[model samples]
Target chain A: MTQQKRKFGFETRMLHAGHIPDPVTGARAVPIYQTTSYVFEDTDKAAQLFELKQYGNIYTRINNPTNAVFEERIASLENGTGAVATASGMAAQFAVFMTLLEPGDEIVSSSHLYGGTKTQFTHTFKKLGVKAHFVDPTDMQAWERAITPKTRALYGETIGNPRGSVLDIEPLAALAHAHNVPLIVDSTFATPYLCRPLDWGADIVVHSATKFIGGHGSSIAGVLIDSGRFDFSSFPTIAAPDPAYHDLKFYETFGHYGFLMKARTVTVRDTGAALSPFNAFLLIQGLETLSVRMERHVQNAQAIAAFLAQHPKVAWVAYAGLPDNPYHALAQKYTPKGPGAVFTFGIKSDNARQAGKTFIESLHLFSHLANVGDARSLVIHPASTTHQQLSDAELEEAGIDAGMIRLSIGLETTEDLLWDLDQALQLT
Target chain B: MGSGPSLAVDVSMNTILSEADRAKYMDPGKIRAALSSTKTIAIVGLSPKPERPSYFVGTYLQYEGYRIIPVNPRATEILGEKAYPDLLSIPHPVDMVNVFRQPEECVEIAQHAVQIGAKTLWLQLRVVNFEAARIAEEAGLTVIMDRCVKIEHGRYSGSLHWVGMNTEIISARRGQRYF
Candidate 1:
């Protein structure tokens, strides 16, 4: 097989970068490697694979052919060295953190993040002795001051979950590099089609492929892509000799691919958060039409956000695509393609919780659910659903309000979504 | 709260340093020369505790074979080195006055670094003062702000890749030994 030389466009790469015709069966699409393990050619080959002397399929848990294609394709799209696919988006982020940090390490993360991620950072990571420092994403000094000697990573979302606050990746990356820490971006909202965080200097980008990457929301998958830029030599977890791999130095051995290799060989091998090949295949299908789907997604979202901002019943809209939004300039600087499709707006009513409930219940076109980045529109009341356990003060800290209605605009026509929202607001 | 406006002014001044000027100070060659040739580093605000960044970076620099002079008024000695009360109190010649102080304190330190005839003035990560940099640069000293010396050493000395940063260089094979 010959490697392609010319750099293809984003849409073209989305369709064709990682896979080619299968030589065995001449299959045109990515074939699911549904088996558990790969057979070794001989004892020498098996020993070489086990020793990290060579790279190939050893076990389905560590590496799968279909998942490898998905990984490569996403990495290419993200302009990264390589990627590791995991069972879910949360798992992908967990694996990357596992590879970068030890028990005593710390991460400075944005306050505006996915609810699931906040819970993981505040709860799960705390149990492992990893501390999370949450700071306002818009406050650069807060991020800087939060960095301590033990800080191993800086983390944020490309476009904040539900809030749609655009991250200033370049400045944040500069700050992280100044401290010799890597910036990890959760770019699930602004998928590579909208924004490539690595191009803005992020060291690693993770995604919940179950969302935008699996456009139809068919697969629960996630990926971790190494920007191949973060200098990790001073970073103990990736650079140091690991007893699990028989004292093999990952960075010394893999060079630019150290994180990807470690995440696969050590973290995935030990933790077992591998993505299934079938999910990888589904994600690949979503990847093929990502460019087109995202175009429609943005168009519909921009229109709905505009409509909501002007509505009499709407109290506030937080989409960065709006010219008046605080993150509008950041959106222009970072995600020039679009500010993304997920956003939230507050209902102007006295009984906001009841109003939000009525609005969501009345929306015939939008699906009231837990997920985003689907072909079908989604509506969720965070204060009533995802974040219901929190008190009023906690809700305020999470940037969620009782009246706030989170919308994940889909590929549906702008008129239909507007009608659904307008009728719902009237009902409320 | 009383220091808000002046700090804002300082940040604004720091932003005026253009990309080209910032690049001049942070040049890999310049960093390499500064790291390899400098023998003594006076670490201002070097903490006694192991958890502080000053202590951690100062220790790393010490391990890398530089003479680390801890500068703290409260501590008589730290990291097995005699701690000076100030840059002016260090009796011996200093190669670099590496500051771990706040941004507001840098201008005075830069002046002291110049008075002491130090070769370089290095502000640690998140400490940037354009006026201090100018004062030091005008006094014929190399000025590097908002960059960690330990990271620069790891990068230029070819040890950074061992941990996994791209370092923008690739090799067909891994043969050379690292520090």
Candidate 2:
């Protein structure tokens, strides 16, 4: 009888991938292997690992057993060939850029981005002579026109931050591939459960595992997952021989795994942004219940979006689930599970800045914070806090309104959350 | 058995070359059964290098409680087990012959496997040879091509997905999550 290859579902992989029952200790759960160095099997084995001729842990900076489990599990969920974990989400982006880009290399990115990302892309990248061209994520023509010969990558968040605009992944991927560039997606808002961008043709996926992947605000970690489908043979960085490692040609040697291996050994190793093993353990625990947590998070978000839309104090809601939302069709196409739990709304008042402050301070249940993807509900007024430095024109370019209050709907009782929002809206 | 063609397993290589019934050969049930039943595996082109794919696969199988015969003429022993130069050199019975050599070398290895009366012939990941497969299958040997024995064992045992392996197989049957 004919049979198909057996792959365990997402939930199963969460619990099992990269984890073997520990034969020596009989450890059932993924053990916290918090060590800076590992004992080599022999001199030959040690040499082999250092030479990149073998896969084994020589140092925590390069690979660890605990981190290996997390990396593999994330790769499995993202449907990628492999993944590498780093210190934070920014580190993941930095590692990718450091691997792919040379001096004067360019990136075309979405303007609708997390505050920190905007700062990194615009400011830090400037110091390195790399340029980032930000465009309206919805404008495919804008993205197309921005790409020049020097452009190394096309980038965007899957469900954009603050304003919940959905990226057109299919067309964006097609556009990037047409120009011999890879589309790098920050899928922090829309986790693998909501939308896997790689399945939609993206080459690399980045995530802040600190948020939904860790569910609780317990860990700060970042990961980059590679689809292994992109051809890097013609690309300068991956295909070229490296002087640092005895002129080893990565793409010629490892084929699909060239970019990721270099990112780990060369970038992560040189930069020293390796994730703490203890933090990786926390992320692993968080990942086990990801699908369950995400379900409730989005469910609460949809109800809260609906609640705020009709409220007298609220002037506008940017949730893609709303019928009048401009990104509704694209949300259906990409993140059909709703455009994530984080979204924004504007308060109707003449003194909008003061009113936004009042709305946040009046909240009893929601914790006013600068973070998202926690079990507890979170609220942030970006204009007064995150985007305070940006000019009116700059804020408009980033899709942020000065009066906008961002709500990352969490796993709270629907009625209780609505009551909190109602009281908060009254104050606004 | 000698390295020459066997009278008992005389067959046409061209008749089974296309492999129209390839699915039957790759059937998950047969693979699981073959893996479970095979006691001894002869790894062709087994390397002495600790980092090589053949070495690690042999080590992993040994850990998984399967006796592995490393077929390398250069190495006297590997992973603390005796290493034979070729499949025919293995005096004891080998239930499966796992090929790690190039596709061009597999046809000869398959012929040797047939002569030795091995039950299954497993080609390592990226080692695809339809002609070798045809020869093995026509001689009543189960053919598993272009797959890593270590990865298949790990997949079955619930411990792979690292080192950039593209894990596409999903099943309704849950694996051993906790041991």
Candidate 3:
């Protein structure tokens, strides 16, 4: 009936939510909990844990105290009830799907996505008998037309990979909810500092903590955060009795925590894709400086996208932060701080593909790599590598041209980065 | 505040409690008042299983010198204390009624708490029922919802943060013992 502002800002939660000082040693920082299993107080306690009748760590494959802090902090930042940490973003995504989807279940997802995810959905999921329908992320009608009775969820990226199209979160979330399904947003690019998708009505949020969350590029990790607002009492996979756990009905039993509980105890336990406590610890360190890193990441990206937009050697730049870009308004609405640091541009030359290769090789600051969201700048020509096997028509359909050079702008000095870009452009 | 069906909200972590709700339900002052003045807690739905949170909490509270009354239909006694099937069956003075039951089951439990004239009605984490909270409030019983008794005690005693948990209380001052 009444409302009040939440205490603890993003930065505060990032540094402190999941952990407190070590009581024994008086250590201020989180210590790496490297052990595989915990000691049970007695035989009864061990039985209780094995039965899943209580909450305590039975094995590292499911959860660890060190990873618990990482999961909790991520959940707090994303405004979710809880989270499950996984080995990678791909693993996190898989854990969620495995928990929610059945053999015949389907999902309607945005066509523009990280190439690895696309392959996972199209090829890998195909083997699992789960169908994924990809539609233009920006077109509301296209998303609607793709949903079927078997569709269990609507999926999208907060920021489209390489294409620079920001997802229409609010509307897409509404569409998913109206269909009695959840919207899962891959917000790897627009980290919670930039956009909290759960605040926009998404039921679940997944992240590649390997990227921005682990700003130093030191660890590969991922997390799945659940808003706990969706009523899954009617959703079959959640509400129905799970045969694996002695006919335990998750939603009816655990209520708001049903999905995450199932995701952890069953999915991660059986899947064997748990995030090691060591990696979780590194990501925790990365989280401590997330807001600081993201601010600079966004600032440099806005400047770099602008610089390349007007360059004579650049044919086109697709950065939502640019005013003339199609998704600029949506970007302002969803990610007003900036449209994330990763974006794409094309070199203006007759043999643009060759020029793109030369441009990548000429850059001193930007490393040519397949990853994005690193603290260091990265350049990738998807057509020549990630999307190399795709025909020109396939590339065009995916909104990537042969000359498309995706840049993940880092926190380097803006002038130095601009100089690097300038020199590389001249070579192109 | 009146007796009726009060739906427990599944509020996100970012949406903190309302000022009125905080003062009435989550305020440190109110929680302290409930904890310091109370010596006995009637645990409704207190599972006998060792791993169940309610059982562990009851065990901890009993160890802390509070008389824990376990209310489970099937258990004759728990943690060396007598068990009652319902609140009304307890013939002794009950200082607080702590609940680990479902949200929908709370309205009836609140009525029993009011009937038994308990001083406080406390719900465990994720066990919030606003109607029950309102009923207990209307009956002049102190109501604390969606908070764990063990955690609150640990927090106030300055031990919750020992394991890297944010107490949400920043202080150069240490937590003072109340009991």
Candidate 4:
């Protein structure tokens, strides 16, 4: 089964690519290994597993069989060496940072990022003595200029959160490579169907599996996919033995899986950020229909973006699918199929607070919660809700005005989504 | 566990000072004193709606033996108390004025809180005003920014629900359990 053909379309792969029937039980469905500790053959086998000489699970916190299947499936989907399943998207980002950075190191990242990611990079990492240099992800030169000697990675989203700006990954990846840094792309918005950043030159891909991957929004989880293209041996700090774990060098032990090994052993092991087996099971179920759901998501989003663009009340629309959008050209270059479900629009009203409130309150089908990327359409006024913590200047920098409304188009029919949106717009 | 001694000192200090002050000065003793002494609170923009955080927090504090004055211009009353239009309109003294308005409206609220002789200005979680916090602090009022009072109360009082593991055993019989 492991020797099966690798070439298959995403939908086929999503169902049966990386996984076969369970070896022991021959179960077609992935089994949930709810146990915490895995049994070893003997004492020597346990030592071997602990010493990284073998590759079987010792503990569920580090790895589990159920999660391994999910990891393999995601890794296969993203074209990565290995993947790590985490407790949440935030935990995934935390695991990545903990594995890659030391105190006083820096990350060159796009200024426009998810609110939680921005907070973690700007506020939380500051406590750890790691600095984040915010740069324009669209501007290749800004990325080049931001890379200093201590810059560890270049980070951006394939489609930026709320703003829906599509990043130009190929050139940005080249810039990162020139600086001896890896490019980490958050592909939560543009799931594997719309765009696979690895094919476009990204070294690492991250996702909030709670969003699209778990399509129903029933589970909160995240994944980190290592492309295995970045050479750890090129950077002495990452390759060298450390005080954190008994002087065992990551690169020396695991070649292509070096970063992933470090991420598993150090970050997930110590921080206890392992994904729940139940959540992994839910995510696997979601992946079965990912390709189909994503297509509908794109169809609905395109229709909504178009509807808003022509509306008299909408001052600006920032969906990449729209031809007049600033990100349309980059979207064509990177994600030509369609920008994933999320996009933002602005109301042309002075009483933005009232307009924003009315728009949200008037929506019948769209839920107005803090989360996005659900099977049902989601909407929020960024100026009053998601990006409310950011200052006016910071909001402007994030391309959010007081009247801006972020919509996460889901699997609903295009006509229904447009009708709901049109009535809401009329109310606004 | 190895850093238990240092962590104890840190927690003790944190008990006395506000989290914002601790982040600024690393003094926890001051936080504990401020918390213990604050008995009366005025919640600005306190909604009558039970679902809102302000309403629930105010109710929780009231249940915990603290006097709560709801201040909202739009509401005539909330939680059976006659709501004042602002802090200045309150008949009694307020120890802490909790501002639940947007960040842009915080400065005016902070000034009113000071004018009403409030001892501290508390901004709900995610509402930040550097200028307001600075002004309140300068006026000899304790200022806490981007923190939920109810969460802090629960955390400090050890009321947080813990799942997973129990180190100690609970027995109905006297000294019956053995490890």
Candidate 5:
């Protein structure tokens, strides 16, 4: 099949780029190849494929053609050399850590991260003999101080989950580079459409495709994009030959594609985090209109943020898009397009807990769901849902108070969104 | 405290629907009855493969005697039934319309179910629309939310195995098994 040129804008590229007409039947759409094994050319070719002598599908658990197209598309969008698709966003991060770090290695990460990421880093990774050092993402000195000889990477999010604080990516990236480590960013909130962290100096990017990338909330998938900028060769542990895969050195064989090759061959190969072809197909369809849907998402979010800021019943609002927001400058520095469509606000009521619950139950248009980045508006009380596992102090540290409510604006009419918010606030 | 029964009876009587409605709608009795009566179900999103939840759920329900009608616009058939594009397009009046579409699209399916005169509108777990529920209710249909009918059937019909138990006696001979 002739590969189509990647010439279209974000919207068009999303729909067409990195994918071509099926050579066999000329099918216009991506066909889900639901099979366990692929037909090898011959015995020698199968040996070459397994020996990492050539790239070809060996098993569905490691890779699939349908999923490869998705990985390629997202890597192109993020301006990365290559990407590794995973079963879910958490699995994507796990692949990154497992491929990059060994026992006793440390990761310097931001305090303001998604609860799941925090748990994975602080608890799960700890059990694996890796430690996590938490610091404020905006504080470059703190990040530098947190780094030690054992520090393997610096991690933060483009837009912190729930808290919505935009990180200063450039300075942090510089700090990580100076410390001989790469910056791993969770860009799930501010997807490449809003801000490409690779363009700003991030060395690696990960996403919960379960969110924005699967905009319609139909599937759970994730992707890890390698910027091809980080010189992993400086770290002999990762650049050297792997004893598991026939002593093949990733950096020597793949060069710029070393990180992604290692992640795919080792992490995904062993742990089995490969995304299903069906989910990948669903995400590709979602990506087709991502650029268009994101614009309306930002506009709706900004308008709702403004309306909530001025409402009598609102105690506080945290949206980087707002001029008075603490992270507004950082948002401008990193994401000039828009801050994103997710933000948190607090309702002013004596029984804020009950009021928040009541408000969520009262919403007509906005569905109360744990997931975000849907085609329809969604609302959640973090104190009761997402951050419920944390105590009062931990919740406060995570910037989630009892009155805090997180809103993920969708591609709905701004008037309808505000109307729903207004009625819900009145009930509160 | 002494008037609790009478007060409970008064509240139950004044409720929008009676105990029968609760038993029919919220309770698993209606689903049990449906399972006993029907042998076929037309799940609109059933895939051909077994990995998908829709495929597994539909297959499981079919295992319990309900025939699954996989309706897909692209597929010729799924699991032996001729896949129809829509409910109206189906040859027979299906006992239930199991939807796997997003919540926003449920209103149209509810309307279609009403048009096809389906006996039940089973919106799969995590997909619900109050407006659709109201419309179905007005059209004399039963609506259940955030529930899997297969799971309910397993729970209410005593067909599932349970392992957890509380015990007092340490010896095996004296130990009690509460059914």
Candidate 6:
């Protein structure tokens, strides 16, 4: 018999691409390699492993079979050369900075980002001697103006959190490429199935696999995908000899796999944001259904957005799916599938905060939560929940409405979801 | 494959080929077997609007007991089932991936269907891609281009006669092949 071609589909890759049936037991499902450490066959092999002469599992913190499968599958989906799995989304972001940055290096970031990420960039990174410049994501000129001699990378989300501000990725990628800086996109919201940033000129992509990628709202994991297209010859981090790894020049040795190699061997090994094998299994399950869930998420969001837009109580809706949205055109070009399921809307009332509270409380189907991109629809009143600490002036400066209602549409029946929103809106 | 080589398919052809003409390119038995065995379908570019033929076909298929997964980014749900933005995003097994998209979009969807392990790729009426069909067939998936699954099911399942439509199938076996 002739050997068959092994060109599998996306779902096939999700189930079988990164793995084969166990030679020992004929097991079909990916077995969770849950051991903490692997034993070496001999002193010579162990020595070679320690010397980085050969690649093999030594420790779970450095690499594991389960995590490797998750990493490879995501890398395939994202159209990346390689990927490094981390403990969480924040860890993935940290690993990127840890691998690329020096003491005096700077990062140009979008002003609109998850509050946690903003704090990490502004406070945590500053303490580590790296400065960050925040710029409006919509203004390409502003991004250019923020870049300085010390700047190493440009960072932004595929879709802005809370506000649903879509990034003009192509222009920003151009800006970063012109300056010889890598554009790192947090594509957690717009998964690779919807938009592959690397195809549009991005150098790096990061994701909080805890959300949609994990679909059922279980497990927390992150991944960093390298396009392997960026030239790191000028960057001292990847190009120069690493004292930690005994003079291993990542760029010179690994070539296209340089970034991922450094991220794994240096950042992940030292910082230790390694994903658990069990969590990797959960993520695998999520990845398998990502296509279907994302479509439902988009459909539910479209229905809810239409409902909110026509409601007399809704002051304004800021969903890219909506025709009047400022980012509609950009979203259509970059993410033609859908503008994503998460969006923000203003609830109108005499005391907008009271109305927001009523609307949130009245909903039985939608869960009031801090997270986004779950299998279940989630709602949060930003002014009262996440942005409660910000003063009214500060909230306005951040472009957050006091009565803003953020919705993360999930995989649910449209009729039930619409009914839930309708009942809640009537109360408001 | 739709035609021997994608290069062989003329770009100027404006209509679907006749059964005899298509027989030169594909096997009808492959499509019949795919429809008979398929249990779940992930419909790419499924519209939420009721008027769309994709919606009605999907609804009718769902009513017939085949699991229908809606694949479109704009809608979260269709006919009570959670929708996916693309074929790759669907977490479960898909027996077939039905395309309700433009011919230009077929290649990407074909790649996604292959990646997702879908057993077959069924392109709706008037939408066809020889390149996509070639890719799917090469990947070992059964490919049925420029045909409606509902029409195929009704024809093969002996349901078309009840609706007064010609099944074009001549056989003594008139019972449903699919349960």
Which of the numbered candidates is closest to the native, going by highest DockQ?
3
Q: Sort all candidates by TM-score, best to worst.
A: 3, 2, 1, 6, 5, 4
Over A179-244, each residue of candidate 4 has an lDDT whose tens digit, in order, gives 888899999998887899999999988999999999997999999988877878866655887566
TM-scores of the models, in the order given = 0.70, 0.81, 0.86, 0.68, 0.69, 0.70
Q: What lDDT score belongs to each candidate, Candidate 1 first?
A: 0.81, 0.82, 0.82, 0.76, 0.76, 0.79
> lDDT tens string, model 2, B27-110?
445666788789999988888775454766776677667998989898899988898888888898999999878889988999
The 10-residue segment of model 1 chain A with minimum total lDDT is: A1-10
DockQ, prediction 5:
0.01
Give the lDDT of residue A170 in candidate 6: 85
Tens digit of per-residue lDDT, candidate 5, span A357-405: 8899899999999888998898899877766777767877766788899
Badly placed stretches (over 4 Å) of model 1 are A1-5, A389-394, B1-179
Measured on C-alpha atoms, candidate 2 has an lDDT of 0.82
lDDT of 1 by residue, A1-428 (tens): 11112335777768765554443455667778899988888886686567654445788898877886787778778877678889999999999998888899999999989878999999999999999999999999999999999999999999988788888999999999999999999999999988999988899999999999999978899999897777777789888888876776777555567778899889988999989999999999999999999989998999999999999999999998899999999898887778989999999999888898999999999999999999999999987887788886888876678899989999988899999999999988
Q: Tens digits of per-residue lDDT for model 6 on A123-207?
A: 9998999999999898888898888999999999998897888888888899998999999999998998788898899999999
Residues B1-179, candidate 5: write the lDDT tens digits.
Answer: 01011111111111234444433344443454455555567787777654345765665676455778888787887766788887779887777878877889889888988898777887766576778878888998767554556544543332210100000001111111223
Docking class of 1: incorrect
**Position A145, candidate 2: lDDT:** 94
lDDT of 4 by residue, B109-167 (tens): 98988898999888876577788988888898877766557645543332210101000
Off by over 4 Å in 2: A1-5, A389-398, B1-129, B148-179
Between prediction 3 and prediction 6, the one with superior TM-score is: 3
- DockQ, per-model, please? 0.01, 0.13, 0.15, 0.01, 0.01, 0.01
| Model 5 interface Cα RMSD in Å | 29.0
Could you give the fnat of all candidates in order?
Answer: 0.00, 0.12, 0.02, 0.00, 0.00, 0.00
What's model 5's lDDT at A10?
61
Pairs that collide in candidate 3 are: A19-B164, A19-B165, A20-B164, A20-B165, B6-B131
Docking class of 6: incorrect
* Better candidate by DockQ, 1 or 4: 1
Clashes of each: 5, 5, 5, 10, 2, 35
